[model samples]
Target: EIESIANHYGWQIIEQEIDKDHIHILIRYSPKWSILEIVRLLKQLTTYRMWQKHEVYLCRHFWKERTFWSDGYFSCSIGNVSKEIIQKYIQEQGR
Candidate 1:
């Protein structure tokens, strides 16, 4: 899902790893890339896919609400951290 979003916006994924509850991926792209637009498209696509595939489950969970996601997401950049450090951190999680 994340990869698709990043790819649609011409972002490059340098590294990726998945944890129990979250995913960590290092992505880069042209300076003109709009983070907001990318995020919006991702959320929309995921929501649509989930709705189509999990309609019954979703309806059972909450008929009043229609959002698969809680609200927002977390994002940050590593300014001083080296690529090796980040890769090691992600790798260590797998062990």
Candidate 2:
């Protein structure tokens, strides 16, 4: 799902890692899209799809609220760092 979203917007997802409770994605996005917009799109679409596929199981945990991801997110630029280093870091998450 995330890959599809990235593809739709022409964002390059260099690497990604999904943990039980969170995800790490190393994505290269266009300057036209703000981080807020990207985060909103990801959480909104992924939450909707997840609910569609696993409503029964999700309802058990999120019965009181229709929330999947947390309200806050963490994002940062690679800055002067190497892309491969970040990709390796993302890949090693949750292991």
User: Which candidate leads in TM-score?
Assistant: 2
Q: Model 2, range 1-95, lDDT digits (tens) per residue? A: 99998999889888999999889999998899999999999999989999999999999999997778999999999999999999999989999
What tens-digit string does per-residue lDDT give for candidate 1 at 1-95? 66777777788888878777666666676868666665667778877888898999999986896776656767667689987898778766644
TM values, all candidates? 0.70, 0.93
Number of backbone collisions per candidate: 0, 0
lDDT of model 2, residue 23 = 94
- Would you list the clashing residue pairs of candidate 2? none
Off by over 4 Å in 1: 91-95
Off by over 4 Å in 2: none
Predict model 2's lDDT versus the native. 0.93
lDDT of each: 0.74, 0.93
| Cα lDDT for residue 93, candidate 1 | 69
